[model samples]
Target: MKFIKTKLLLAIMTSAIISAPFAIADDTSFNSEIKKAIADSKVGISFRARYEGVDEDGINGASDIEATALTIKSRLTLQTGDYKHWSIGLEVDNVTAVIDNYNDLTNSYNGSDSIVIDPEGTDVNQAFLQFNTQKVKLTAGRQRILHNNQRFIGGVDWRQNEQTYDGYRIQYAVNDTVSLDYSFVHNANRIFEENSKKSNNLSGAFHFANAGYKINKAHTLSAFAYVLDFNKAHAMSSNTYGLLYQGNFGAIKVNLSAATQSDAGDNPLSYDASYYNAEIATELGKITLLGGLEVLGSDKGKAAFSTPFATLHKFQGFADKFLGTGSSTGMANGVEDTYITVKTTLNDVKLAATFHDLVSNEGHIDCGTEVDLIAAYSFKKDYDLLIKFASYSANELSNDTHKLWIQVATKF
Candidate 1:
C-alpha cells in the first residue's frame, strides 16, 4: 500500500512538471512565449572537491579509529525565464567518492573506520514551478527553503548532497514592513543519499509558517510555528513555536530568540521543552567578535528540544557531537552550548575561530568542549579554497575526536 502511494505521488509530480508551462500559457501567444522563455533561460554548473580526515580516541576498549575520505560533488541547474508570471527551475547533483577509506555511515559503514556522511549518488536536488508577482510568490514541487538564518528550517547545503523538501511554498509581502511565508512539506530529502541503507528520507506532514515585521530600519521581529508529523520517525514529531528579534545598534548587533516544543502526532513521548538563544556581535578594528548562549531545555531528562530539520552542523559545534538530541539514540538530558567566535579578513582570506563549552541541561553532565578553525579564500570571481579543522575533547560525552577538511570549489 505504501509503495502504491509513493508511486502515485511521483506520478503526480512528474505530470505537474510536464504540464506546468502549458497550464500557465495563453492560447494566443503560447508558442512565442515558449520561445522567449527558452531564450531567456539560464544554466548554472558548479563543482566542489574536498578531502576530509578524522581521528578519534578508542571507545569501549575498541581500537582508535582513523580514516580519510576524498569526494567531489557536481551540480547543474536550469531556470527558465518567466512566461505569464510562471517559471520553472531544475537542479541535479552528483557526489562521487575519489577515496572511500572512511565510512559514509550508509552502505559503506565498515565498523572500524570513522564516519563521514557524504554518500555517493546522483539525484534530482530540486525541481519546482514558480509563479511570482510584485508582492506574492508561489512555488510547488521539490524545492529549497530557508527561513531566518536556518536555525529551525534550512537546506543543509554544506553537505555533499543538500537537503531539500518536496513541498509547496508561498510568500506574501503585506506592504513594505510586514511579510508572511509558509510551506507545506510532504517529504524531506535528507543528506544521506538515495542509495543509503539508512532511512535517507522522511515522509511527513510538515507545516511551517512565519510572519515578519520591520519595527524600524535597524530592527526586525519575526514569529514562527512548525508542526511536524513524521510517518515513521514518530520520535521527531513535534510542534514548535518561537519568536526572533534582531537589532543593529550602531557598531553593535543583537539577536535573541525563544521557542517551545511539545510532543505531537503519534509520538509516544509526552513532554515539553524550551529553547533559547542570545547572541551579540560587534566589530573591533579588523576583527569581529561574537558571543552567545544556546540552551535546548529538557523535560526532566525524558525528552529534549531538537532541530532535526535544521542545519545542525552550523550550530552546537562543527564536530557535530550533539546532532542526535531528542531522538532515541540521542541525549535525552538536553544540552547547553556556550560559545564565542572571532572572525577577520586579511589579504583576501577569511578566517574564523570558535570555542564551545557543552553540558547537559538537566543532569548537569559535562558533555565536552571543542575548538574550530576555518580559513577560506575566494579568487577569480567563482573559485574558492577552504581549510577547516575541529578538535573536541570529551569529559562525559562521546570520544575525543579531531577532524580536518580541505576543499576547493568553482561555480559558473
Candidate 2:
C-alpha cells in the first residue's frame, strides 16, 4: 500500500511537471497571467502566546498533581491569486515552549506532572492547490476542513498544533439555497504534533459527504454521512449518519442535531449507539442566555458513541476529564451533559460563564459538575487578550480539577 501511494504521488507530480511547459509554450498570455497572479498574492502572519496552569486531586492512592506550561505559536501563510481559476496556498506553524513544567504526553514516562498535550515542533500546516468556478470549488493536498459547529469533524484549531487532513475536497453550490460538499481523506495530522510516541496520527480511507438547504431566511437544514476506516486504529473507525437544523427566530435561536453510529473496518468491537443535542439561545437587553442538553448513548455496558475526530475540548468540560468515550476513559456507560451559558459585553470586553451537570447515560451515575469562565478583549482588531478558568467537582467519575489560562494574540 505504501508503495502504491508513493507511486501515485510521483505520477501526479511527474504529470504536472511535464504538462506545465507545453501549456505555457502554447498559450501566448501565460506570462502576463502568471505575473498578475504573483502581483495579487497575499501573505499573512499570526502569533499566540499562552500560559496555562492545572491542578488536580489524585485518584486512588496517587499524589495530587500540578503543572504549568507557557507556549507560543507562530504561523505564516501565503496564498496566490487566481490564475485561470487555479491558485495555491501554503502555511507553516511553529510552537515553542518558554516554560515547560508539564508532561506533554510525548515522552514514555510522565513522572508526577499533570498532562498538558502540547508539544514544541515545526510543521507544514497546509499546502494545497485549488480550482474555483462560478458554482464549484475543489481543493487537494493538506488542508483544513470543518463542518457545521465542528462537533463531529473539525480542525481543532483551539490547540497550538491544529488538526488538518491530507485529502481532496469538492463543493458545489446548486443554487443560492442548496449546496453539497464531499471529501476523501487519507491522513489526519493530529494536535499532538509530529514525531510523538503517542501515535497521535491516523491514516485511512475516510469519506465525508454533506448536503445543505436553506429553507428560508430564518431556517436551514443539513444532512451528512461520515465513513472512517482506520488502518491501525480500528477502534476509532465507524460510520455515522446525522441531521442538523438551525433556526433563527425574531428573538430566539435554536439548534438541533441527531446521529447514529456503528462499528466499521477491522474494528474488534461490535456496537451501535446514538447521539443527540438540542440547544436554544435568546438575548434580553444586554445579556444573552443559552441552554443545551447533549447525550452520547451507550450500547449495554460494552461500548459507547465516540467522536474521535471532533474538537473534544469544546464539548464536555474544559477540565478535560471525559476526553474520550471508550471504556478506557471510564465512559463505557456514555455521558449526558446538561449545560447553560450566560454572556454579556461590558466596556468592550467580552465576558461569558458556563455551568455543566454531567452524568452517565446508561448507569445513571453522577459524573460531575463544572463551572467555566472567560473574559476577552480585542484591541485595534489585531491584538487580543484572554483569560479563562474552569473548575470541576468530581462525583463518581474522575478527580476534582481546576485549570486557568491567560493568552495574548496578534495577527497581521
Candidate 3:
C-alpha cells in the first residue's frame, strides 16, 4: 500500500514539474478555457448502485432458498491539460452483502475465494494518474483492466467493488491501424482476502506485461505475459501467456483466442492451466446472431482456473455458471462448454437471449444448460431501464435446482 501511494505521489509531482513552465504561457480561447477548468479544479464524478436477486436453487446437494445482493460504487477523476498532459483517477467501492448462501451461488468454501463479489471489504477501489498525447499515453495507480469480452481473462464482476491492479501502464500508437500497449502491476486486489490456514490476509504485489496489434482493418490481436509473485507465503507460483485474435467481415465477425500457463506448483497444487474460446457473430438487418464454444484444460481432471480474484461477472455467463474450476484437484482435468445468443433492437429498446450447455471436457456427464434473457429501453435522455432473468437446471444433481435475477441501472 505504501509503495502504491509513493507512485501516486510521484506521478503528481512529475505532472507538476512538466506543467510549471506553462504557468505563464500565452493562452488562446481553448487554452484559456482549459486553464479556467484547471483553476476551478479539473475533476469529475461517477456513481453506480445495483440490486440483484436469485430464486430458489440447490448446488451439490446443498439447498438454497431465495437471496439478494446490493452494491454501490463511486469514482472521482481529476485531470490536467498542458503541453505536459497529466491526470489522476480514484475509485471507492462498497457493498451491502455477499452472495447470499440461500441462493446456492456462493462458491467460496474451500481453497480460493468465491466467484461472486458482493463481499465484505473496504479500501479505495482504484487510484491512478495518466499522461497522454497523439503519440503516447501513460497511466499508473490502482485501476481496472478490461479486454475484448473479458472471457478467458477478467476481474470477477459479481462483486460491488471490482478487481483493480496497482500498477503503471503505457500505450504508443504507430498509426491508424497499429499500436503498442504495456502495463506493470505491483498489487492485485483480488476478489477475496488471502485465506491463510487461519488468518485472512489480503495484501500484496504482483507484476505483468501486455501488448496489442492490428493486422488489418478487420483483424486485431493481443498478447500478455504475467508473473504473480505474491507478498506472502505461497510457493509453486506460475507464469501466464496468451494470444487473442478478432476479425470482422461486413456484417459478420469472429473471435478466436488461446492461452497457456505454467506454475512451479502451489504446495500440492496441480500447476498449469490452458483455455480457449471462439465465437462468431452475424448481423441480419436489425437482429444479430452469436454462437461460441469454450474449453479449459489442466494436467489433472480440473478446469483451467481463471482469475478467481477477478470480477467474475465478465466470464462464463451473467448467470455465472462456470465460476471456478469444476475441480481444483481431480483426475479428469478439463471442462468444455458452448453457447449461443441473439440480439435485436426495437427503436430505443434492446433485447437479448442466450443458451448454454456444459460438461467435463474429458467426460460425457452433462454439467447443465442455462437460459438468460435481458431487455433495456433508453430514454432520449441519458437514462435507461433494464431487466435481466437467468435460469439453470442440472441433468444429474437434484440439488442443482435453478437460479434467477433481475436488475435496473441509470446514468447521466
Candidate 4:
C-alpha cells in the first residue's frame, strides 16, 4: 500500500513539472483578456527534489545505522492584485517522500533506520495579507521571517516543509540609510511536521525588533532585540540584545557581531550568557579565502548562549553538531568554533569548502573537527543542481558522522 501511494505521488509530481511551461503560457495569455483579473496579480511555482543519505554510529545500542531519503517539495503561490493598498497571498506546499528508507520520526515504523528530519506531508505553507507603501510595509499571517543574517531568527528553508510563523510583521524605512523592523509572533510552526507527536509547535508572545544603518558601500551596522515568551515551552523563553557590523576594505570583508542572552518570562532558572563572532574574508583573483571564530559562552553551566530559532545548519558546522537546544538551555556547556573557508567560481559552477575546529569555552576541551564541501551549477535560467557533503571527526563530543546530498531545484 505504501509503495502504491508513493508511486502515485511521484507520477502526479512528474506531470506537474512537465505541464508547467504550458500552464504558464496559458496564464500569460489569459491575463491579457482580463486585465482586472491578473493585472497586478502574480503566481509562482517552485519545485525541489533532493536525495540525502546519513551514516551515524551508535543508535539505540546499535553499532551503526545508515539511511537514505528521496524527498520532493512542491509549492504553488497566488497573489491577488492590489486594491487600495491591500493585497492577499496564499501558498500551498507539499512534500512527498518517494524513497523512505529512513526514519522520518513521524511514521509508525521506528528504529529500523537513522533519523532523517524531512518528513513527507502536504500543508498550507503561507497565507498572508499585506499592506505596503513606499516607506512602510505591514504583513500579517503565516509567513517566513528572516532577520539580519538569519543568526538569531530565520525560516529554516533547508527542510522540506520549512519553518514558518503565524503572526504579524512590520517594517519602516526611516530614510535611505536607516530602517526599523519588528514582528509579533503568536505561534511558531516548526519543521518537524504536524504529524510528529514530538512538539512541532511553540506558542508565545514573541517580540523581535531591529534597527539598521547603512554607512556606505563598505560598511553597515545594526542593533536588534528579541523577547520570547513561550507558553507551552516556558523553559525556552529568553531575551536577547545584540549588535552587528559588516564592512569591506577594498578586497577584504569583515563581520563583527556580539550578543547577550538571559532567561525571561517565566523561565525556571535565572542565568545570563554572552556570544561573540568575528570573520574576515578576501578575494585573490577568482578564489576567496575566509577565517572566523565564534564563541557561545555559558553562565556557570546554568545557561548557554542560544539561538534556538536560528538557521543553525548554516552555522556551527554543516554537519549540524551544534544546532542548540530547542529551549533557552541551549548547550549545557559553552562552545567555541574556529573555522576557515574557501570559495571560487569556475565555468559557471560555484564551489565552497569549509573546515571547523570545535572546542569548549568553559573547560577548553577539544570537541571535534569537521569539513564541508558544496558545488552548485545553474544549467538553465530556472534550473539548478547542487551537490554537498559534510564529514565530522569526533574527539570526545558527539559522534563521527557523514552526510551527502544531491538536489535539483526549479522556479517559475
TM-score of each: 0.94, 0.93, 0.78, 0.89
Instruction: Go through the candidates in order and give the clash count of each.
Output: 0, 0, 14, 1
lDDT of prediction 4:
0.82
Best by lDDT: 1
**Higher lDDT: candidate 1 or 3?**
1
Q: Global lDDT of each model?
A: 0.89, 0.87, 0.60, 0.82
Expressed as tens digits, the lDDT of each residue in 95-148 for candidate 2 is 899989988877554567888877888777777789999999999887899999
Ranking by TM-score: 1, 2, 4, 3
Q: Higher lDDT: candidate 3 or 4?
A: 4
Residues 90-165 of candidate 3: C-alpha lDDT, one tens digit per residue:
5555444434442212334442222333544455666667787998988877777764565533554545545666
How do the residues 1-412 of candidate 4 rate in per-residue lDDT, one tens digit apiece?
0111342345346534533433343456444444443477799999999999999877347688788999999999988675556666767788899999988777475667877788877776667778889999999877789998898998888888777787899999999999999999987777886557556778899999999999997899999999999897777789999999999998889999999999999989788989999999999999999999999888877777778778888987877878763334456678899999999999999999999999877677788899999999998799999999999898887778899999999999
Off by over 4 Å in 3: 1-42, 59-63, 80-83, 94-116, 120-122, 152-158, 191-205, 231-236, 265-272, 302-305, 309-311, 326-332, 397-404
TM-score of 1: 0.94
Tell me which residue pairs clash in candidate 4.
236-328
lDDT of candidate model 1 versus the reference? 0.89
Best by TM-score: 1
TM-score, candidate number 2: 0.93
